[model samples]
Target: MRATVIRAPHDIRVEEVADAVVREPADAVVRVLRACICGSDLWAYRGESARQPGQRIGHEFLGVVEGTGADVTGFAPGDLVVAPFVWSDGTCEYCAEGLQTSCPRGGFWGSAGSDGGQGEAVRVPFADGTLVKLPADAASDDRLLTGLLALSDVLGTGHHAAVGAGVAPGSTVAVVGDGAVGLCGVLAARRLGADRIIALGRHTARTDIARLFGATDVVAARGEEAVAAVREMTGGHGAQAVIEAVGTEQSMRTAVGIARDGGAIGYVGVPHGSGTGLDLSVMFDRNIALRGGVAPVRAYIPELLPDVLDGTIDPSPVFDLAVPLGGVPGGYKAMDERTALKVLVTP
Candidate 1:
């Protein structure tokens, strides 16, 4: 089997590796049909996040079950499935509360000795709890494939931002950033019934998709200018909820500044930069509620899967570029260079 390995910053290679196989009774092996590079993956790609030489990378994928351990049930060979970026045991207390990302027995893909997602296959732990079965016909269509693949991570993360920010019917929401996750946030805010969606971004391509996904306004401004634009749209009151998708200091400040006093700010971007960390004094003074972390994607996957299958929400536009498995390095470069919003890989 071939898999992506991050040897160092700006160095991603697809090379032959040992095949993924089930090693525990609760595990299953999935033959990946589609995989993708996540914005979070760029942290290591840029060397901002530490990486070991030859470390397996990536964590968004959907595939067909090739084999399962004895203890795994409700899934079998040939079943089409999607695995959340994090693997969790459904029986845990945190999982019971719809917070699978915090499950004590859970861990992320490409870490803790698990196979990475951007590979031909993966050994999925907590098989019954982590893999969501899809209709066998689901993978046959290009649009559906893109949507389902989004469900594996980005869409679910965006949904988390909307939910975390307390988006509700007739609410005014602003999404910070125009990355795949940001665009997906626009879609999620609409699906959740937000009356007005403001997308803060500069890229025409991404902003275009944001509009298609349901952004009522696109503010191609940054910093205080962006903040003023959002407040102006809300009659000097800012949005009721703000989704911070970029995870940078400037983006976070923009999200906070554009959120109405006492409103919630849902952020899911992998935090980076020196000033990106939380500032308690600011939140305390404004009575702002900050909610979000690594998204509990498994919890939302089932909630959002029906919408994808029913044609109610299409997030496929995020994958603007596609490449073969061996061409993953180009995919990384495309994303890093801002030439592609997101890249999809096929085995």
Candidate 2:
């Protein structure tokens, strides 16, 4: 089998690797049909995240089950399923409370000896708890396939940001950044019944998609100007909720600045940049509630899967380009250069 590996920052390669096989009774092997490059993956690509020289990479994927361990019963060979970026035992207390990302027995893909998602096949630990089976009649259309792929990470992460920000019916919501996750935040906000959605991004192409996903307005401004624009849009009160998708000091400041005094911020971006301090005084003075972390994608998949399958909300547009498994290095480059919104990898 061939898989993607990062030998160094900006150095991505697809090379032959050992075949995936069931190693635990709770595991399953999946023949990856589709995979994607995530913004978070760029952290390592840019040499920001710590990783070994020859580490396997990627974590968003869906595929057909090729085999399962004796203890796995929720699925069987030939079943189509989506693997959450993180694997967890569904029986854990945290999983019971919808916090699977924090499950004691849970771990992320491509970590702790798990095969990365961008590969021919991967060994899925806690298979029954981590894989979501698709309907037998799942659409073969590329759009539907792309949308299903989003459920594994971007869409679910966006939903988590919105929910954490306390977005509600009739609420005014603002999203920072225009990445795939940011655009998905716009979609998630609309689905949650937000009356107005303000999207902040400098790229016209991305902002256009944000609008299509339900952004009521696009602010191409930056820094204080961006903050002022969102504030003005909310009649000087700022947004009731703000979703910070960029995970940078500047993006976080923008999110906090554009949220009303009693509003909340849902930050999903993997925080990067120089070690920046959070202004507790400002948050305290404004009574702002800040919440977010690695999204528990498994918890949100069931809620968003129906929407994707029924075509009620298609997030497929995020994948502006698709390449074969062997072309994964270019896919990573395209994302790093911002030449592509998100790259889908077909294995």
Candidate 3:
């Protein structure tokens, strides 16, 4: 079998590796149909996140079950499913309370907890607890389900960002960054009932996608100018909710600086050190709420899965390019260099 590995920053290679197998009774082995590169993957690929030689990289996937343990009843070999980026033992205390990302038994592949998703097959532990069954029409739904795949992480990450920011009905929300996660934030904010949605992006292509996702306004400002534009859009009071989808310092600053007093900031951008100290006096005096971290995607998937099935929300547009596993390095480079908003890799 072959798996994707980041030999070093700016260098990704698809190397032959040992095959993955079902070693645990609670595990399921999946034959991946498509696995997309994520900004999070870029973190490790770019030397921003810690990783070792031969670490299997990749986390978002859409695939068919090749085998499952006896204890798993919700699925079988040949069934297509969407697994959340975070793999958790559903019976844990955190999982029971709807915080799968924090599950004590949860395993985040390609990261510290477990293996990764960029390969021929994946051994998903706690199969019954983590993978979601897609519609019976999964064959036809495959190509159209990229957004659902995105939901397994980025889309869900975006939704979590908006919710963390405290977006509400009739409130104006602003999003920083125009990447797949940020564009998805626009969609999530609208779904959460934000009436006026603003997206801050410098790229025309990305900003266009943001508008399509329900951004009522687009600000093509960079750095502090973007922050000022967001404030000006909300009548100088700033947005009631600001979603920070870019992990860089500039975008993080834009998210916090553009938020209104008493408002909230939801940040879910893989945190490449963008999270810093805010003016304590300003935040404390204004009563602003700050919330976000790794998104609890598994907890939110059940609610969002139906929306994808019913066609109410389509996140597939984020996948502007798709490639085979062997071409995954190009996929990573395209995304890291901003040549593509999101790249899908089929393994």
Candidate 4:
């Protein structure tokens, strides 16, 4: 089998690796059918996140069951399923509270000694808890299949941002990024019945998708200028709910600046750099609430999956580029260069 490996900054390759197989009673080997790159992966690709040479990369995928260990019973060979980026034991206390990311025995894919999603197959741990069964008919529909794939990460993360920010009927919401997750945030706000969605981004191509996803306004500015634009649009009140999809000092500052007094900010972006751009004094003075972190996407899948299957929300448009397993290096380059929004990998 061949899988993607990070050799160094700006270098990704598809290399032969050991085959995936069930290694534990709770394990299952899945023949990957669809996989995609994530925005967070770029941190390591750009050398901002450390990785050993030859470390496996990628952590979102859906596939068909190939084999299952004796203890696994929820799925059988030929069952279609999706694996969250992280694997967790469904029986854990955190999982029961809908926080599977904190499951005691949970672990992320592509970590050392684990198989990556950007490969022909993967050996999934805690199989029944980690893999969600998908309808078999999804395999024959490319668009629907792609939408289902989004449930593995970005869509769920965006929904988590909306939930965290307390988006509700007739609420005014603002999203702070235009990447795939940000665009998905727009869709999520719409799904939650937000009447006004302000998307802050400079890229016209991405903002266009934001509009399609129900962004009522687009603020193509940065820093305080963007904050003023949003405030003015809201009659100097700012948005009631803000989704910070870009994990950066400046973006977080912008989110804080544009949130209305007593409003909430849901931050789903994976924080990077040395500073967090958070000011406790301002939040305290304004009575603003801060929520959200690494999204527990595994817990969101069940609630969001039905909408994806029913065509109520289509996240597939975020996947602007497609690549075969052999073309993964180019896929990474395209994403790093900002030429692609997201890359769909067909193994």
Candidate 5:
């Protein structure tokens, strides 16, 4: 068996590794049919953070069940499933409350778990709780791989932002970035009935997709300028809802500044591990409710799964490159260089 490993920053390698086996009664092993490079993966790749050498390096994936524990009743051998980035016990208090990302005992795949997501077959604990069953047909079909793979992360995260932001029909919304997640946010907003979608993006191609995903407008601005533009678009009233997709100081500021005084700001960026200098005085003055962070992906996956199956949402457009697992290094380079909005890896 082989897996993608990042031994160090900018040091990704594909090496043959030991095969995975079930370690618990709730565990299962998945033969990955498809996996993807996530935006958070880039944080470790570009030296922003440290990734254990050879740590399994992927989390968003879809696969066929190769084996399952005796107690697992919801899945079987050869069943296709979507594995959320975080594995959780669905019965946990948090999971029960629709916040699986915060499950007390949940383990994130690309971090403290057995390994990363970029591999041929991987050990998956809590199989019944973590993997979402997809239509049997999609398991063997490569065409459905792209969209099916998205249920694990970006698409789910995007849906989280929209739901959290309360995007209403005929409402004006502002999306704070143009990355895959940001574009997906635009798509999610449209699905929620937001009418005027303003995407703040500088890249022509990314912004174009934002429009395709349902953004009614685009702005090539940054920092305060971008916030100003979003306000101007709303006739100085600011957007009724704002999706902060970029986890940066500037992105957060822009999201806060461009939202209507009483509007909600739903953010799902990875926080880039930076402190936000939020002005409490202003936030209080505006009566704005600012909330958003790590999306409880598992909570949204089930809801968004049908849309992808019925062809109602084409989230796959975010993939600018799809590479084999062995070429995982290129996935890092492509995203780091801004050559790709999102990269998908086939294992």
Candidate 6:
């Protein structure tokens, strides 16, 4: 089998690796059908996130069950399923509370000694808990499969941002960033019934998708200028709910600046750099609430899967580029160069 491996900064390759197989009673081997690159993966690609010379990469995928260990009963061969970026034991207290990311035995894919999603197949641990069964018909529908693939990460993360920010009927929401997750945040705010969605981004193509996803307004500015635009649009009140999907000091500050007094900010962008630029004094004085972190996407899958299947929300548009397993290096380059929003990998 061949899988993507990070040789160094700006060096991603598809190399032959050991085959995936069930290694534990709670394990399952899945032949990947659809996989995609994540924005977070760029950290390693850019050398911002450390990785060994040959570490596996990628973390979103859906596939058909090739085999399952004896103790795994929730899935069987030929079942279509999606695996969350992180695997968790469904029985953990954290999982029961819908925080599978904190499960005691949970682990992320592509970590050392683990198989990555950007491969032909993967050996999944805690199979029943980590894999969500998809409708058999989804396997034959490319569009539906792409939408289902978003549930493995971005869609669920965006939904988490909405839920964390308390988006509700008629609420005014602002989404920071215009990347795939940010665009998905716009869709999520719409799904939650937000009447006004303000998307902050500079990219024309991405903002166009934001509009299609229900962004009532697009602020193409950045820094305090963007904050002023959002505030003015809201009559100096700012948005009631803000989804901070870009993990950066400036973006975080923009989220805080554009949130109405007593409003909430749901931040799901994987924090990078030295400081978060969070000011406790301002939040305290304004009674603003801060929520969200690494999204527990595994928990949100069940809630959002129905909408994807029914075509109520289509996240597939975020996948602007498609690549075969052999073209993964170019896929990474395209994303790194900002030429692609998201890359769909067909193995």
* Top candidate (lDDT): 6
Whole-model lDDT for model 5 versus the true structure?
A: 0.86
Model 5 per-residue lDDT tens digits across residues 159-185: 888877889888888999899999999
TM-score of each: 0.98, 0.98, 0.96, 0.99, 0.97, 0.99
lDDT of 1 by residue, 55-156 (tens): 899899999999999999879999999999999999989999989999899988887467899999999989998999999998789789878999999999
Clashing pairs in 1: none
lDDT tens digits, residues 1-347, model 6? 99999999999999999999999999999999999999999999999999999989999999999999999999999999999989999998999999999999999899989999999999999998899999999899999999999999999999999999999999999999899999999999999999999999899999999999999999999999999999999999999999999899889999999999999999999999998868889989998898998889999999999999999999999999999999999999999999999999999
lDDT of 2 by residue, 12-88 (tens): 88989899999999999999989999999999999999888878899999999999999999999999899899999
Candidate 6, poorest ten consecutive residues by summed lDDT: 275-284
Residue-level lDDT tens digits of model 4 in 1-347 = 99999999989999999999999999999999999999999998999999889989999999999999999999999999999889999998999998999998998888888988899999999999999999999999999999999988899889888988889999999999999999999999999999999999999989999999999999999999999999999999999999999899999999999999999999899999899898879989988888998778889898999999999999999999999999899999999999999999999
Worst 10 residues of 4 by lDDT: 287-296
Worst 10 residues of 3 by lDDT: 271-280
Q: Extract clashing residue pairs from model 4.
A: none
Against the hidden true structure, what lDDT does model 1 obtain?
0.92
Q: How many clashes (backbone atoms < 3 Å, residues ≥3 apart in a chain or on different chains) does model 5 have?
A: 4
Clash counts for all predictions: 0, 0, 2, 0, 4, 0
* Candidate 3 whole-model C-alpha lDDT, 0 to 1: 0.84
* Candidate 5 Cα outliers beyond 4 Å, as residue runs: none
Better of 2 and 4 by lDDT: 4
> Who is ahead in TM-score, 2 or 3?
2
